[model samples]
Target: MLASVAAGLASTALGGAASAEGGGVPALQLITLTGPGTSGGDTGPGELLARQDAVLAKVGNPTTTYRWTTALNGFAVELTPEQVAVVESDPEVASVEANSVRPMSARRTPVPSSAQVRQPRATGGAGVVIGLVDSGLAPESPLFAGVPGLGRGPKDFAGSCEVGEDWPATTCNRKVVASGWWVAGFGPERIRSSEHLSPRDAVGHGTQVASVAAGNAGVSVRMRGRTIGEFGGIAPQARIAPYKACWGAPDPRDDGCATADLVSAIDRATADGVDVLDLAVAGPPGTDTVERALLGAAEADIVVVAAAGNDGREEYAAHGSPWVTTVGASLGSVWQGRVSVVGGPTLTGASRSRRTSPPTRLVLGADAAAPGATRRHAAQCRPGSLDAAATAGRAVYCERGGIGRIDKSEAVALADGVAMVLGNVRPGPVVDDFHAVPTVQLSAPDAQRLTRWVRSHDRTSIRMSGVAPSPVAGRTAAWSPSGDPRSSVIKPDVVAVGDGVLGAVPDQRGWAMFGGTSAAAARVAGAAALLRSRHDWRAPVVRSVLATTAVPLGTESVLRQGGGRAGADVRGARLALVVRTPRYREVLESGSWGDLNQSSVLVRATGSVTRRVTNLGSRAEYFSAQAIGFTRHRVRVTPLAARLSPGETATFRITVTGPSTPGHVDDGWIRWRGARGSVTRVPVAITR
Candidate 1:
């Protein structure tokens, strides 16, 4: 039976909200350029270059020229919004749009310490290199202090010389360097007072994300100890190489990363030989430049992990690739708070505030406008009832659906009367959103009672209170991306704690809470580092072991949950098998006689033997053999067939061959076709 952490508390039924308004200007459509076909006729660098030149000539230089690539065909150029009109007028232009940019938001939830039933032993991921392809890194930050074997200071992929030491203020030279290109979007422009060139993390999302995978918790105190905070991150010892890409400034002219810059970062990280790559960004669902870069990482043998997105909508595209592990969010006990709503006939002009109380044996149907009453989807609510419930100071109940909980909350707020909202119930416990309103999520049965009570009586009172403590095993969050529907190949092979996670921020004194598959991916990467440290396994071996060892989340055949939980044994098992195989063989001849047609001598073998197999990997392995000669000859062996667990037993086999003329006796050995250590070898014994 597979061991798994149960699903965390389900989120309360609330509306999903977009980022706070007025922070950054929304994305605008820009000019688009097309390239030559990438089919057999136009396949080659020369064809691509010619296509690029043609596209560039038509656009005519203005502010800047950004180059992007389609999954097929040649390069696509991204021009300024003004240039977009001009480019579209040209005969060769294909399409135009505002640069495809998305605002970064917190997604993955943090895991509560109470949920961590088993603390993984500290494995050395010190030697494994991780590349943070973000804005830039702060050399003086506590996260990077005293770290040894730092792989060179951050190189200017954007080609900016005036590198700042702090956030947001750091500037990238936009002269269109040989490799990197600057495009348009949102966020910071000028370098901040600090020394880091990366965008100022005023939003405090990216820094928190980086720290989750590589930063040592508690080492940086500014980032508080939310269950998602300091104690997070899988590989504390791994080194980080940051790449400045996104800018968090408000200037339309100075924010965001160009597609070219993103590609260059991928190349740089690959060239630097980073072991793990964490990309917390997302975009459109189709085959775009960003998706290709992720694919490139897979081809390069680097483990790429990305966020599954936190929009609460399932229609969004995931950061998907065969090599990339997408992560999701689950509720943690530390983040749970019980809310109570009290209303009675005697009560008048009573104004109540949201409070966090200890867990208690609270009874249902005690009050009308109870705290845990709202659902995630607006569609789940009774027709026209949500609006009525919101206005009359009554609690609202809704079923979970596609619409965001934030939107529902905003609607309730607008109603000006509803005390709170209750979400639909699920099998596991439910979680509340990061909203400030008095919202509570109840199980399906609880939601039904509240709905029935409001219908039965015009004046109804409700009171609810319960303290939800963290669980021993981390809840399996559902945000992680699963396998493609058509193909059962696991897309996201593992899960880790990502919601409400805490980590480093841009400024020295501030820390932020972050969540999403991005953080989970980083944690998995760190775990991979630990496996690498303990065993000599490559990327494939490590990937296989992790997948096979994952404890199943549940019987649910969902894709996002994947093979299940990730641990050291899962990460190291496959590599151990590779190490056990005999890669090289040496033959020795005993005697050389002149006239004798055949000679029989003793044969011996010598080589290094390593047996580091763990209990999780000690299974029976089978083997087979075959001998071929001048005229379809058959060979007999001492042990026809045998089974051996790794390191436990070694059986010897002798083959008597029926041969022909004097040339060379080749004893062939063939093992079962699909077995782990299956091999075919020829043992040469020459006769005088």
Candidate 2:
């Protein structure tokens, strides 16, 4: 009788507002509830739905599409503006945000090494679970097959597989412990026929990421019926749990992930007990609803790694929250194609093509223009711009830009061209994409020189061969964006080898080279899983350990390389964390980037900060501190030397006093050496 009376009161209160906005479609909003009745222990799903239904009765109670309770206490619902106002007025609501749809922002080795760099022993990440929150997976690929010695699945993991078309419950094996997909917020009408309805990856992004993070070891990557090399994941023994939140579209660039779906995936992964979360997708900065869920994930002891956007140095890195480790792309072991000018010096450039071509006549793209085609179009090798007669049996030079790199090769193939020489116009990183025909890619200066040589002589012939490994170690890729000056926390906390990383594709037995920070994040995520498997540490400690021990990659500023390349040299390395007192924590409690207890330091203004380090070694030792690489600023460290016993903790202070010049930045490292051979380094960035 009491329940009937409450329902009657709700109807009376909401009946008039049912059609308050009149006739337009309702907008979806994500509402995060707090206080009581948020967690599963506090409120049952049925009871919560009844409460929500009564509250939303004023606006014609729509079905709640998503209910996130683990990592985030939120629900997604379609409501009119008037209805949103009603929800906002409720005392349980913490935040109400419009469901925002964002575009999908789309690592070669098991350990961090190439032909030129020193190799570290691979740490098989046994008993670790890496949760990938991105596109679906290719369950049939051999990369996700069970290992030889692997026994039972992880005891702590409670994730399950969602059976769908081409995806059976049996697909989730010991290697892939969990598989699921959420596309409710992405809308069913937007899903294309080419995409899968299950966790099976129609788009290859998720598979590539999973392969780089935790695929089976010693898998042969055979392309075009030839074995390229034996490849494996950095943490080959770790288990994978993939949650597909992003969906494919007809236009590849139109591929996007709904924010509502992202939050739900994060929530589920947290509940599933994943040790590491690899997020390759990009989203807006600051404390939005999604970032809030990331904080919840961190609080749940999950180490989150995200991709620094591929927008290049002009834009700031995305997902710059201090809680998540943002990773940038860097070129490692490179495969170059050699183009020998019949009588001129041979030019070596980036290449992903496996085929080699003998000497053939080379023609400028503009010189082979079809009738009625614009010179610009012909130069860019746009489809239908090349004349078949002029381009037949010749190596066409197509300038980068205007169209897809593969599209240029397609146009060349359509013109009966035997080969292509693709070149960039401006200074930037050259991606080695697998093309339709044999091709060579050159930088701006080299391309300009080649163009001049081609036009100067009437008959220019060139021979293209070799796609062998030529290591370009350490330098950060130009396409990976720099850190934001506005944020207090330095972004791109580490760099990883992202260029020309070979990984699994959607097709069975297919492998391809991938680039961008997506690959870099996977590498770091794998490394984080390795750390978790080796030691019992908190998420923040794991992040600090990686950042502090990173080796410098090139001469770029900390804004570009942060703590240099992502490395795990924790052997005899001291753990340093920024000291944050209770007062400071309360003052900056909104997941403050500046207040994070990270080892790396980023001083936007002249200020003094304190750090604490604990000796995790077995014996007592004395340590000395020294500053390296600092210029244009006064960096002083107090207590330059300290003596501590095993398991002892010590505190130190670092003061930065410098000119308040705008846009001026300085970088260096705080190195500490212990008498017992212990060494630790912390990256520092100061900006004015």
Candidate 3:
């Protein structure tokens, strides 16, 4: 079945539920405030204190800073916009604007399945290079087994002495060249590790991602295999080149390697002649440095694919850059078809003190909910409350929080009343699983509407139709990045099946259920590898072919699905045979120019035809021709287009150009069709 594309929105009340942490409020940026004489003199400590007091009085006790350096010579104060205005209005104040503010994290929207693959076919990219830039990776992953021409082992970007399979160490390895490292508390620490330090994935994010890209199929390594953990990756046949970029703890503040390390990794991948490059990490939105590096890689013909980000917002600009294929997340089947709701009725108070209610009836609808019912105090069931609705057997609604909603929903389900929980947030609803109870998420607006309806009329009813429990096309998963509507570029071009994906981990343990765009990206990379094995094409060309061939999903238009879903079609991958003269060529080549061309060629299946035409141009070209007494049948073509770039050759099928024209002497020509076209004449001797 084809994948569909649609926006997934979370539906729930606004408050701590919707917030990331600290009472659900987003992190506030500490903006610095300066006053007119704040920087002029080398004031004594007493004077500094007096000045701070005066400023505080004017701004109603704004936070004051005494730390002064050459970089910041003025007395600094932190304040909100209202406070800043008051301080600026004071006669003593010079100027005030936000010096720093907390910006939104990078997010991505998942592309539909149509954008992922077009057809399923066995091609030859089985052994290709895929570069992984993330936390350390496990050296002995099953994905890398038996891969031919695998290069030298992983290189540590961060220096740490505890070389083999251990966590980061304080000691330094003088022999090991340190690229960069992030310490637990400090920023950018020096690394010191040696002794043939095999890549050790302490955090398992990198290892899990690599497994998705090239894990060996059906190979059980074993770790969290039974009871909530099983492992498998997308491309179980490709090889990987690991580059350790993320270090230290998972905290972003402590890790400050910046774009330098990422750029270096790209260069390294290109140098190694890697076929595919996977970047599961993301940076702040609007960061041009990362975009530039990705573009450079794309220009080099390296297929660049990146994670859209887990932030439930829009796709980050860096990932949306036209050069790279961004990936988003989607709920796996485990949560798609179920129903959920707030476990109990709302209550009145700060503490989430509430009583559990009896189980309610289940309602069928889209995964997301319509928003309604504000959380007054911590618990209080209003007439149309989500908890009340859930107690009646309907799906529960919740908001995105720092603590995973999945665990929370599971807890609610265990309470005996709730069936499932839907997570509401910026990108939309997500199915956060707490227990086996089926769950589906909805957008905030949708959840609100449902709440409003239930309140207005003692009971609420919702009926959902369309593909249920079916994979969505172009719908960003919780882990993929969201696209910026203001920017008008859909990121994370497509999504591959990644949730509950099984693959290898550390300690020879195999089969772990991993979720994230990294896994999906790996699957695509492995597929690309297979295509490469059949035909040698540049990275961009391969990406283009995949994009163009994809099938659209959902009721939405092309923007949602991009081109379509990804399919490994061995049949479609084979070049079509067509025969034509110069007249046909004129019609085929009338479009815009591109790096490749497609032509339809014709040949007598049972006759003595040993040679056929091959497209060597940069644009996709096509050729069409007719044959007498020849039937069409499938035949294997050499050097599939996936392996060829511009100036490369791959044998196509043979076709008879036209019927014998006695006076004019019939001749054959190849015509380009599809994205662009060109015509070429081939010498053929015809006898009546």
Candidate 4:
């Protein structure tokens, strides 16, 4: 519940709210420019973006107005509202949106930690380079400190730290091989005043995410100022090159990493010969600058993994393009303290607030707001609206869908409310969130009942205490799944454990708890790095192997779970099936009315597509393919089973005939299996 809420709040809180340009006066807002370069134009995503430096210089004071967005046509500059209008007048400008950043965390890493779980002594991902494109790195963290066999940078890597005034020139070390920052955001002087002068992570997010992907092994997890458990990254042996695309962390949470900065980092990482690029950032939809850059990275043989945005409500809100390997957030097993209503259900949430008084004197926020504000605003717990006279030292009832859960807690506490009960607007399940005051989120039905009770009953009370581990462990987080039905493209390509993962903070000895698809993408990136270390595979092969070998979650739909939970056991299988054919999402996009029906694809059409299956094991392997799930159309695979040598690939032709009927989605997978349960499932969704 909080993950989706936090996503919105994170955008608002991290990137300061954009002040409107009133009276046609000059104001600071991100402006995107597009068109053929009149003065000078560059072709292609890379060259076009390089031309942006010149375009930005022409529009505003270069030093103060930061240029965002990578490609030549798109940019975020502080232009006058009139100047923005001037840009809009250009026919070439594709689209423009206000710039913002998403809050994106650590744990054993069910990762690099999971790798150790299977082989306790092994630190996976030797000889691979992983580039972290987020906040800069804290090279001094124990996770990045030099050690014997560990901490060695990949010799082929060719990137260096962009030193800051505060960051010593020697900041780049063997473990943190490279570092750079793109702070060309809305505010520069203010950013410099509050931010460190170098690529160092004053904001802890980049460090935390990088460490989660390839941090050194055997770091300890601390809470309440004491060690609770040992922490590790997914691929402990991979080299880390920090690319600080976003900045302003550790305070005010300014993660407004513009597109220009991201483009530079990605281009640099690709040139530096990194094996994988890990990004925890997101941008507006459509094929924008960074989206194009990611596609370029994919074509260059680099594995690009990105987060499915935290927005659970909108469809295709995720920043992922077609080629990138998109990942979604799933729960990791966790136990947290509970806060339940007197007659309501137990809720799963986290808070640092300590409640000393007996649970009683329940007061709803709508009842506490100052006069004139609607009950809805009161339930939203808008700041300053709550009257201290009405709700002093009582647990305030707040709704989840309106504002960030933490923001709600702050508003209630500001009103002198002792605690907060966050009721979820969307029913079914809750994701835990860290809070400033005593806060617990209720599920939908429970929240609805709590609201009715608050309206009907003058007095309400609730019980609070520690609770058992959440019953739903490692389930697809509601916000993690892409719900946009308008776009037929299936997403997240796969799911990974992201909730409550632990990783390093910028503070020398500090650590943090984060929950989002950002962490999930990092784990998958690290897993890919681990695979890179063991096998010489193309980007598609790596993606296919991971998807095929993943532990399929049987409950969720193919769109929700994709290939299931990521579990790439490089050491486990002697033969793995890698799918190369119509992508699951592509088939979905091809359907009419979102299905292969007579009204949609009215003509019964026949199409033949070649599916390539590769055996990536150490020896020759035998395999067969079967179409399982709903049969909306007829599919025939010639030579269903085959024997192939190690590293050899076989091609199978699949003939499909469109059906006469229409349906939501005909879901199934082309399953390929080998000895020892080595299996690969290419999820298929077509309607007619």
Number of the predicted model whose lDDT against the real structure is largest: 2
Q: Which number leads on TM-score?
A: 2
Residues 71-165 of candidate 1: C-alpha lDDT, one tens digit per residue: 22223333344445555686655454444555443552343222221232333465566666555543344554544433233232222222223
Assess each prediction's global lDDT (C-alpha) against the native: 0.42, 0.76, 0.40, 0.62
How large is the C-alpha RMSD of every model relative to the true structure? 18.5, 7.1, 20.8, 12.1
Question: In model 2, which runs have C-alpha deviations exceeding 4 angstroms?
Answer: 1-24, 35-61, 107-123, 151-153, 336-474, 568-572, 578-595, 676-678
Assess the local accuracy of residue 410 in candidate 1 as a C-alpha lDDT between 0 and 100.
Answer: 51
- Any runs in candidate 1 off by more than 4 Å, and if so which? 1-76, 79-98, 108-123, 135-140, 147-162, 165-202, 217-232, 249-261, 331-490, 567-572, 575-688
Candidate 4: stretches off by over 4 Å: 1-121, 190-194, 249-254, 334-471, 483-489, 572-609, 631-636, 654-663
Q: Which whole-number lDDT from 0 to 100 does residue 175 have in model 1?
A: 12
Q: Estimate, for each residue in 23-83, the C-alpha lDDT of model 4 and write its tens digit.
A: 3444334444454221112355566556555554444432223332322235444445655
TM-score of each: 0.50, 0.77, 0.44, 0.65
Ranking by TM-score: 2, 4, 1, 3
Summarize candidate 3's per-residue lDDT along 275-337 as a digit string, tens digits. 667877665664243444454455445677776555544544237554566655443342233
RMSD of 3: 20.8
Give the Å shift of residue 365 in candidate 1: 24
Ten-residue region with minimum lDDT total, candidate 2: 109-118
Q: Is candidate 2 or candidate 3 better by TM-score?
A: 2
